[model samples]
Target chain A: MNRTQLFEQIKKKSSYLCVGLDTDVDKIPTHLRSAADPVFEFNKQIIDATIDLCVAYKPNIAFYEALGPKGWESLQKTLEYIPKDVFTIADAKRGDIGNTSALYAKAFFEHMSFDSITVAPYMGEDSVKPFLKFKNKWVILLAHTSNPGADDFQLLQSTGSGKKLYEEVILKSQQWATPDKLMYVVGATQAEKIGGIRVLAPDHFFLVPGIGAQGGDLAQVSKFGMNKQCGLLVNSARNIIYASSDKDFATAAKSEATKVRNEMENLLNSLL
Target chain B: MNRTQLFEQIKKKSSYLCVGLDTDVDKIPTHLRSAADPVFEFNKQIIDATIDLCVAYKPNIAFYEALGPKGWESLQKTLEYIPKDVFTIADAKRGDIGNTSALYAKAFFEHMSFDSITVAPYMGEDSVKPFLKFKNKWVILLAHTSNPGADDFQLLQSTGSGKKLYEEVILKSQQWATPDKLMYVVGATQAEKIGGIRVLAPDHFFLVPGIGAQGGDLAQVSKFGMNKQCGLLVNSARNIIYASSDKDFATAAKSEATKVRNEMENLLNSLL
Candidate 1:
């Protein structure tokens, strides 16, 4: 919920890996199809198999949303399945008008019980601030993303700082909330720049996606990105979710998740 | 769900209003609380009552997501309740890794059947291009937001053209998708600047929020932003939803919606 609590969980679990529940219906094991809600069934299994090994479960909302009502039902159930000690992220990338964002904060935090939700900061403070109003919830603002088009706007220089637009977003947004509640979304693909990001907001967490399927080196990410509390949630979605796709799909997912968690454990151990 | 079909619905309804379903749990009618899922119940009622009055229903995903599993359920039901002829917008504002975005596209278009979804373009083309790949669906990119902090990044001038960051985004993103499938969110509060926006994106539909509660002037927005097919969806969310707190909330909402529709009709007439 808060930074220290999140840090303690990472230490307790001996891992900083956040299993991304980016569950695609077609991608789920065929065995799950007969379950009441296949997506949730799959997620429940994954959480059941891997909860002790990881400190977080980041469910990318799109996967569940794609199934229509059933998909949403699955998403809700999956959120419920995740343990309270593990940080949960909607990974919704939501930000909007102030009042609307306030409602969104309530949706993810109050309703779903996610400890955090990823936010797009393009709309500025008003769009992001409403989410921060929730006690202990984190707002992971988009800083330097890993995508190719990240060059288009985020890398552009701003008036206040010769630094890129994302840098400006990071520096400027810090005024709105404290590091304990405010985090940054630094693409794991941009692993080389994690040090620069840490310099910007030294205390906040970074929801680093683009790790496995997206080709982000975990070594570099952990090396340059981790803070004193191992402040990086390295999310691996596809590589783990589709690790086997056989009868042992959930077991295979656990193995894949374990591999990442093991590497993260190594990194955390090295940090001391 | 394509541009022509969307345009036809606008003409048939004689209104360019897109009622925003930024429904908050605390804001919902007490009667709906008795239902199994109050948010969905509220959305079902709103859709049933306002079906013919507006051409589109933009459910701000945050509100539904805030309720967690139920919030997503409400979003699904709201999408289902909307008439097929009326455009449905998943105002989720999602943008992320290409693989993740592909899933988001599937969730909104293939699963939920939304005609369009809002996205944040700060991550650049790769983050946005995946959404554009869906046929007949639109990506309503955030260009100039209405919030006060919008000045922080969107209004900043890029180096070469002296164009504002949003202006540069408008010009460059136009190359990714045709105006038919791409729309920019130009805030109604920036009505005076719409003329400038038109210079870059003359024909793309503008999902204009902030008209009612955000103090965006409709007249100025239409005068500067309108294109031949009345290429503007003026959203009025809170001013309509919370129009009345009493038992007559639906009736009151209809009256408020009707007033905006009448004004939109007048705007259309003037444009024609």
Candidate 2:
């Protein structure tokens, strides 16, 4: 999906929610275990429940990867099941050298047909540039992550640039891609810093994780992070998906997603 | 495999050579295309021919992932085909949040049964710590990479510690894992810097790539990077694997591996 189409989906839904499919086999409802492929079955119902409530689906690749070959089959099925209009983000934090990164681009973009894939910026511009070559695809580069370990290297100040490492990443990466092709993963936990990052890359969308399960405030994220285009796809996974492990799991997931979407709707109204 | 087991393999084989199984379907011999699983067939032959010449096999994950589920099956088969005593390195530069990283560790260590997996250290301590939890599995962290893009962030001086970002990675990561469990990727192209890195972590092995295809010098890597335990696994992929795309491909691969192993043998002798 292009930036304009993604914005259109957001406006149509009245929510910029990106439901994260971090579906673990052990965490799913036990009743589904008898099914041939429980992981895909669980994801299918979750998508059915929440499809209209969100504009994007971010499937954390690690969950599928841990399951091995069968897991990848589940992933392929899940990706094909998601409506083409809704943006699909392969939350695979993949980055490597130029040639290898090209293969990764082929894996997610060409082969699997995800609209975007999250990339780690540690390998720098050449690693990121490969993904940009594909038209209408997005590269959501990691900036200030939500994890406690984000403080490790991301926050360090670079002597040459005088900006913090992530700030430098944002600044340097702008030279490689425009807002239409590039986005940043600014954790909702770092809500205050979003305003500053907005100033740095004012037009680029921010894929905001850490909203619900990670203790990030949705109101703060909307207040500080939103651009005119509704440039925030606030993600909530466990709080919504695992809301109920009973037979009513899908219905419970819908209720949770509705609650969050309603809050997002109110936030959008307040903006006007 | 543990450190002692790995060193024993190096001594027993008289080489610290690591053959990179970066198997691309397009690059394999055309005759093999008729096989049901050409990539696996090519890899099996490569393993059969050169298993004794090298101590480690580093399979770059992106290549297989590009082919989807069947590719993963090939990877699994190739992993199972390798001799248990030889070390297996999943050159999958994967790292994420604590919970997610744990799943990655499980994917490579538990599901795939790799001895060690390469991890990008941009996410910090918590991201890396999960991979260390497995009993004898290893985390080979990226230090100074061989790519031209490595110059971007890794070489920059950090204002906080007055050290290069890669240097800080080396120092901080030491607190996470001992030499027994941790290794660093010090590219053979950065041969001059390997001496300094060796001083930083004298006992930890260095998985050095960029020997043949990338123009890294073998003599320099052996002289500066090798410790008393021959703590270096020099990797050469394209130069060895694609030595000939003909009927003699496997034999040609074996010959290239032999030539490199002979050079490594001479280096090992000089060290004694």
Candidate 3:
């Protein structure tokens, strides 16, 4: 579950895609609703069908959280089903005071058996450091988000230093943890600037979401963002998970995953 | 509840207090452990005992998320148990892509009835605007945090702007939502600089969370951070909820809440 193991898996699979499990109940095909736990069943199929084509599985916490208790049960079962060789991320953007954060780290890393959890950097170092205390776990900090309103503050020139707030976060957070346990979320839609970001934190992995449905170019991201280790975890959620709404939804998901993985294979090959 | 309604309750109670329901299962009283759902039972008692003394109840999402399915059930029950007159906040620091954020807004405001939610401003406008779309809801943005390592980025001056990152977040987030639908998380521990922050965000309410265990001076925060409308919701989580673990835990919680409210009343009186 450590960074080295994660990187080795990425190489062995010839893929860096992290399938995002942002499953919404109403959005899933109607046929699966009758299952004991529809969400878990959906995730289980996706994992079984495409585990070899991905290096990571990211389950956004909000989706499970929305369903309340049943959703949580699905999340726990889904986590248990994911192969240990593949990295698991509880895409829960949690950040709080130190003590509270320590408990959060324990929840995802120990209690739930996740390899990592997404953390919001807005709360500062103490909030993030608690998660960093766990060995072999990664803390994915939000950088330039893909949303249209990302310009409101993240891109605003800091009144004192004149750098964008995200750039400031990238520079400062480097002191809290190394590339091994720290990663940055550089939205794939922000591909143009990935070159600049790589310059700042050249060795760290970047959890690049926003590909597929978000309109981010895969080749562009690979060209500008890739490091010696192919430091990019390109995530595709809607395009893969909901590729087909029929009873063959799992099979459809695997095909979509393979397509993306094939494209990534080409990108990784070019890297060498 | 709208901002005006929250203000009225604050004045009526003579308390600008927002007790935090960071209900950690590990820390719940041993007696409650035998209950079917100890976390919910513990939260229900806390809400019943302190509902009259405080204007709002803010629940940190991590504690609920830690317990998985059962924990989420406790959170839902606790949210429903809170009185209609009091404001409810899902203290989830959520900010994501615009589409994903819109779903989060629906989950918290429409699906569930939380009146407000804390948000990380790192993603800028689109990530925050989704939360503001609902009527009579508030998006409390993270500004200068109460954590020790906030200096990592929030305190750093922009490369040329001469303004700190937190100051920029306060100023720019104004464009995304009006003060009526938005608030800022200005840490109480940053009392010395509250005067400066008040100047930048004079109209927006601030959810200050470092008063008790963090050693922030309530008086200093009131003097420097308060506005004409008494726009400060000072929060004390651990110091109040875990005030005493004895059988009189609820009574001890009420006493601690009363002490903060009394101090706040004095501050309000002086401000007027």
Candidate 4:
């Protein structure tokens, strides 16, 4: 969906919660393993249970890819299953050179039909621009990631610009595309920095992925991160999907998602 | 293969050349497009032709991934077809959180049985170390890439160390893994920087791309980048694989491989 449509979805749902599908087969309940495609089955149930509570679904590509060929099939099936109204982010942090990046764009954008795919900006402008070419597709650039590893390189100061590498990324990348076609993956763990990063890209959406399971508070994220457009996609995967391990897993997922969505609704009410 | 074994393969073949299997479906021979699996068929022929000449085969994952499940099947078949002695680099360029990174590591090293997988170092130490946990499998970290975008963040100076971001990456990443399992993706396009980068990590192998197709010179790279063990696997993808788009594509690929290998033999002779 385009930026306007995405914002509309946020307004309609009163929740910008993005349910992450980082579905690990081993982590799922033992009962589901008997299914033909355990991963897909788990994803299908999660989608069915939580669709109303979230506006986006991010399938962490590593989990699917680890399963080999069957994994790709499952992933394809999962993407097909996800309703088009909700935004889909292929949390496939893929980036390469010019020609190769185009191929990656084709993989996620054309073949799989994801609305956006997260891309690592360490490779620079040319690596990012190819994905931006698709009319409605979004390029969610890694800015300040939530992972402990974010401290490793994201904070380096550019020799010329004197901005932190990610700040440089945020500023430099804006020249490539407008806020409509681009977003930043700002980790929810670093809520203090969210205000600063939001100021840098005031209008662009931030796909925040650290609220649950990663110890990030939604209130702080909402307070600092909400734009006039309510531009924040707070993602929680394991916390909701694995809320229960048995046959009640999907129902439990709904309960957890409802709680989060209710919280999101109150936050949105304050902002609107 | 281990570093010593990889070096031995270089000695045995008299070549440190790495043939990149970036087999695009549209770019393959017309006759092969009619086959059961065109990409695998094309890769099979190319592998058969160039197997003896190159010491390593780096399959650029974007090409296969773009084709979806079928492409992955082709990659698996091609991986199975390649002889074990030659080092296999899954040019997947993947990196994420600790658990997620492990899955990607399993995807390539365990599922596909690749000797090494290239990873983007943007997310920091935790994102990269999981891939290092695999025994005898290498993590070819992206240090200096060949694309025009390498100038983006790679050249930025770190706040504390005053090292360029890529230099900081090369130096800081050393703490996570030893030279035994860690290598750098130092692009051959940056020949002038190779000597200085060589000074930082003298023992670690540098998987150099951008040689033939991207205007990188082998001799210049050899003059600056080579170590006592011939620690460089220069990659050539489109130039070798798409030498001819006809049924003679394999023959032309072999001819191109022969030419590159001959040059590499002379370079290795001087180094040894």
DockQ: which candidate is best? 4
- lDDT string for model 2 (A1-272, tens) is 89999888888899999999999999889999999999999999999999999999999999999999999999999999998999999999999988999999999998899999999988788889999999999999999999989889988899988998889889989999999999999998878999999999999999999988899999999999999998999999999899999888999999999999999999998654
Q: For each candidate in the order shown, give its overall lDDT on alpha carbons.
A: 0.83, 0.93, 0.86, 0.92
Which stretches in model 1 have alpha-carbon errors above 4 Å?
B8-14, B28-53, B68-78, B247-254
| Alpha-carbon shift of residue A222 in model 2 (angstroms) | 1.2
Per-model TM-score, in order, reads 0.90, 0.99, 0.94, 0.99
Chain B TM-scores across candidates? 0.97, 0.98, 0.98, 0.98
Which of 2 and 4 is ahead in DockQ? 4
| lDDT by residue (tens digit), candidate 4, B33-97 | 88999888888899999999999898999999998998899999999999999899999889898
Superposed by TM-score, candidate 4 places the C-alpha of residue B231 at a distance from the truth, in angstroms, of: 0.7
TM accuracy, model 2: 0.99
Per-residue C-alpha lDDT of model 4 across residues A1-272, encoded as one tens digit per residue: 99999989998988899999999988888989999999999999999999998999999999999998899999999999998999999999999998999999999999999999999998999999999999999999999999998987888776677789889999999999999999999999978899999889999999999898999999999888999999999999999999999989999999999999999999999777
DockQ of 3: 0.60
Lowest lDDT block of 10, candidate 4 chain A: A152-161
Candidate 3 lDDT score relative to the true structure: 0.86
Candidate 3 lDDT over A1-272, as tens digits, reads 77778779988999999999999888788888898888988888889889989999999987876666677788889999987899888888788878878878988988798888888887788889989988788899887777677766677566665567788889989998999999998888878899999999999999999899989999999999999989899999999999998888888999999999999999999665
What's the residue-level lDDT of A75 in candidate 2?
Answer: 94
lDDT digits (tens) for residues B99-130 of candidate 2: 99999999999998999999998888888999
lDDT by residue (B1-272, candidate 1, tens digit) is: 88888888888888999998888778887877788878877777777767778998898876666565556666777777777898888888888767778888887887678899999888888888888887888999999988787887787776667778999889999889999899998888879899889878888899998898889999899999889978899898889888987678888889888988888888888655
- Evaluate every candidate with DockQ and list the scores: 0.63, 0.82, 0.60, 0.85
Q: Over the full model, what C-alpha lDDT does candidate 1 score relative to the true structure?
A: 0.83
Between the candidate structures 1 and 4, which one is better when assessed by DockQ? 4
